[model samples]
Target chain A: MEKRVTVLAGDGIGKEVTDAAVVVLEAVAKKYGHMFRFDHQLVGGAAVDAKNNPLPEETVASCEASDAILLGAVGGPKWDHNPPALRAEQGLLRLRKQFDLFANLRPVKAVSTLIQSSPLKEDIAKDVDMMIVRELTGGVYFGTPSLYNDEEAVDTMPYSRPEIERIVDKAFEIAMKRNKRITSVDKANVLATSRLWRQIVDEKKAQYPEVEVRHQLVDSVAMSIITSPKDFDVILTENMFGDILSDEASVITGSLGLLPSASIRSDGFGMYEPVHGTAPEIAGQNIANPAAAILSAAMMLTYSFDMLEEAQAIEDAVYGTFEDGYFTGDLTKDQPLGTKEWTEKVLQRLQA
Target chain B: MEKRVTVLAGDGIGKEVTDAAVVVLEAVAKKYGHMFRFDHQLVGGAAVDAKNNPLPEETVASCEASDAILLGAVGGPKWDHNPPALRAEQGLLRLRKQFDLFANLRPVKAVSTLIQSSPLKEDIAKDVDMMIVRELTGGVYFGTPSLYNDEEAVDTMPYSRPEIERIVDKAFEIAMKRNKRITSVDKANVLATSRLWRQIVDEKKAQYPEVEVRHQLVDSVAMSIITSPKDFDVILTENMFGDILSDEASVITGSLGLLPSASIRSDGFGMYEPVHGTAPEIAGQNIANPAAAILSAAMMLTYSFDMLEEAQAIEDAVYGTFEDGYFTGDLTKDQPLGTKEWTEKVLQRLQA
Candidate 1:
């Protein structure tokens, strides 16, 4: 199974880490009798510097032609002064917009072996595994009345019938694949957007009788995610709420560098990436973790294409690495590894 | 010092816990040589039962005449079917509006002993002593255009020049009183509400020359608070954002049962209460934890009456109890203390 992968090693440590992940992907391909082809494309600040376009047409074409796209980190202090349209982050936003990736799957699971490193007590974080299915491209972030006049400004939290219909349906469908429990998070008590969200969720509930649906306020859900992540299964919320909650959920897992997300469209074209930003200060140091990017490769294979066995192989390798206490600086303070060592360890585990 | 305290222990656990808190406060008064007088009023479902209004005129009058108000948790499942206007939460909102309580201060800190009970890893939870200074009266909750017009619905996230100014000022003032570091949490990258929030905070930064002001998106801050809670000092956000973030922050500290909040007006009047709601199931049972309600009594003494030493004494006593691992069921799985016993413990510690 030789896959044509477009790697957007965007900027800063993205180049180093993505390069490391590429090496691992090649090793996995060899170990499994598969073809893993790589096509590099410019994005983020690099794209801005090259073509004055953060997400150039060539990059989009490359992604469109490939089976899946893997992006390294985007944005940095260099593009801090750039206008919104030309900024490094615009590349990510544009890429997300271009794909129409409706559902963002962020799995927050405490690497059980590394639970001692978590800021939370061992009992609460131990054995905690949950996936946050956040609805992308809608709600407050894209809502209207997002108007600015001479003096006053407004940002509307709007949700159309179809928008709520698809996201909630996606969430329920995702929930069906998980613990069979779905916690629909919203601000229904205050925001009309949430009331619509809850209404749609209620309507969609009858279709998936096997899945349990419970509604909680965004605030309460945010607190619950931290207080007791073990109590939750799949947390489905709107765009902005998901943006906030997913990141918060990422923290308690004690593995920011190992987390991966898949933003896929209904028709299957998707962008996979690590959740962290470009740490320019760590660029060229070879100390940045590559596991998240590598895990993203696994997600791309599992989701964008149908290769569950390969995905499992990568995930198992990650678990094995954590079990051995071989980690990048971000994961462990004492047994830190450089990018090459971590990548080699994971690939070596894959072979074993 | 004789202090006039109004007790509005409205509905369910409110009655029992308030009774327990009253016993504790009285003990403190006798121990501290502070003369105190008490006034009782009906609100929430209790008020509807007595006067057909969630916040009756008599109750409002009683609260207004008192030096400071101490409230029990309000609302329960019995009132769940009531219209929004007749709900137990409305009485609390009414009190906020009646007293013009525009600022809400919630201190979120994980107890050294109770940290084991939290889902967060112990390292992240260790030094999370942060105060969330929220603008209580403004933002999406009470903003204009917050009504359902026909099948179409609307809610506003509105703020004015003075509204932002005052809240930012209050946050900075509180920062001066605490760690002298202030984080203004908003969504400037997306929402105009946050854009205005950032502008005001930027303008106010000059006034607080010594106060270090940092601006962060609400989503990132939410994640940071959980993953590295010790990094923050004071979090300042608008009404709805505050409501969400503060509640999220509270959970990091372990139990909502141990957290207290103060809602105050610029003029001086304050309404202090535990952040948790009425637990209808625990209403008749004597096992409800009274530490939060008791702590609310401490806040009432300091913030409302300018009795700082008294407040510190109450706080120290509460901490000493937790520091010794003397906790209620909410903190850990133990032979849980009943409400009466928990109240007695904190009051007894005040003497030591």
Candidate 2:
């Protein structure tokens, strides 16, 4: 099998981590006997410096022609004074809009080796492995008539049946692949959009009869996430609730630097990236952790390319490196491995 | 000094806890030499059973005539099947609407004696004594044109200058009384209402120059609540964000049975209640924990009556009872105190 991938190594540490992930991807391809073509494109601060546009036409064209896109990180203080349209984050947002990437999958699994670093008690954080499926493009964030003046301000939260249906369907599909349990979260009793959201989930439940489903209020789920995170499988929520919850879930493991995320459409076309951002201070230092970026490549392999076994192999190799007592600067104060050295450790395991 | 207090011992263990709180209030009044008048009113399922209305007209009248109101807990499974308007929770909502209780205050403090029960590590939960002030009557929860049909649903989040001003002022005033620091939370970068909310907080900051203020995005604040809860003094947010965050903050202490909340107007008139709900299974049993209800009375003394010293006295006594290794069934497994026994312990400390 052959697949063309777009690599948008945006800026700063983005290049270093993406390079590390590409090395891992190349190793995976060699071992699995697959042809993988890489197309590098400019985006974010780097694109703004070169083309004066954070998202250039050529970059979009390359991504549109690819099977999957893997982004490193975007933004730096140097471009902080730029207008909204010229900003680094706007590039990623526009790409999502362009591809209609409506579902954001953030899977937070507490690594056994890092359990002691978790804010939650070891007993509570030990077995917390859940996927948070966030509806990325709809709801309050993009709802129309978001206007404000000196006297008043208003933002709308609008959800149509089609929008809710697509995301709920994605959650159900993901649930079917994993634990077959879905916790649909909303404020159904208050907001009309949430009521519609809940209704759509109920309708979708009938189509996937084998998957167990339960509805929870946003507030109740917030408490439950901390009190009993092991109880959840796939947490499906609208844009704003998902935004807050996904971020909240990110911190429990205390391994923010090693979490990966994917924003994909229904057709499995996705842009994968590390949950961490550009570390401008550590740019080109060869010291930033590349585990998240490597894991993101693993996600793209599974979600976009349907190479589940290869993805599992890459994941096991990454975790095995940590289990073998290797450390990154972010994860430890003791002898830490450089970006290149850490990727070497993972590669050695994969090759062996 | 003289004050009239209205007590709404709603249902289930509500009567027992409120009765326990009333006993503490009586003891405080006797020690402080204050003339206190107590008036009992019916609400929730109790009101529904007696008057066929969850919030009876007479109950509202009594609350209006009182200087402050203390609610135990409301709603039980017996009323779970009732119509929407007749539900037990509606009574509490109507009461808030009737009194224009726009600011909901929930304070979470990790007690030294109970620190071991926190879900977070001891160091992270040790100094978590933050107050969350939520805007209750505005935002998406009660916004206009909240309509949904087969195709689409929409809910407006509108905030007027006056609405934001009052809540911000309340938060600032509370900050002045506490640690003199406030963290105003909003999603200013994306939502128009949040931008306006931030503007109002900034505008009000000049009026209270002694108070230190900072603006935080709602998502970031959610993560911070768990990662570094001790960093916050007062968290001010809109209705929905508050609902989710306040609940999230509640579980970190792992002492849900001992948290208190308040819904107040700008003029200081307020209704106090425990953060815990009506536990129908524990109803008519003398083993229910009354710590939260007792704490609500403490909040009433400080906020409604301006009896700060008297409030501190009650607080110290309650903590002292716990420090002495006494606890209700909810907090212990070894020879737990009954409701009356716990109240007696608190009373003993108050008298001492």
- lDDT score at residue B125, model 2, on the 0-100 scale: 93
Worst 10 residues of 1 chain A by lDDT: A147-156
- Where does candidate 2 chain B have its weakest 10-residue lDDT segment? B251-260
lDDT of 1 at B71: 92
Q: What lDDT tens digits, residue by residue, belong to model 2 across residues A1-352? A: 8999999999889999999999999999999999899999999999999999999999999999999999999999989899988999888999999999999999998888898999999998887989999999999999988999999999999999989999999999899888999999999989899888888898889999999999999999999889889999999999999999999999988787899999999999999999999999998999999999999999999889989999999999999999898978999888999999999999999999
Question: Which candidate ranks first by TM-score, i.e. highest?
Answer: 2
Encode model 1's per-residue lDDT on B1-352: one tens digit a residue.
Answer: 8878889998878887778778767877887787889899998988877787899998888887888888987787777788888887799988988788898999887778777656666676777889898998876666666655224455677777777787788788778877899989988878887887788788889988999999998888887887778989999988877888988888776666788889987766788888887887777788777888888888787777777787788888888887877767666577777777777788778776
Angstrom error at residue B76, model 1: 2.2
lDDT at position B226, candidate 2: 91
Which TM-score values does chain B get in all models? 0.93, 0.99
Candidate 1 residue B304 C-alpha distance from true site, Å: 1.8
**Native RMSD of candidate 1 (Å):** 3.2
**Candidate number with greatest lDDT:** 2
The 10-residue segment of model 1 chain B with minimum total lDDT is: B145-154
Query: After TM-score superposition, what is the CA distance of residue A296 in candidate 2 from its true location, in Å?
Result: 0.5
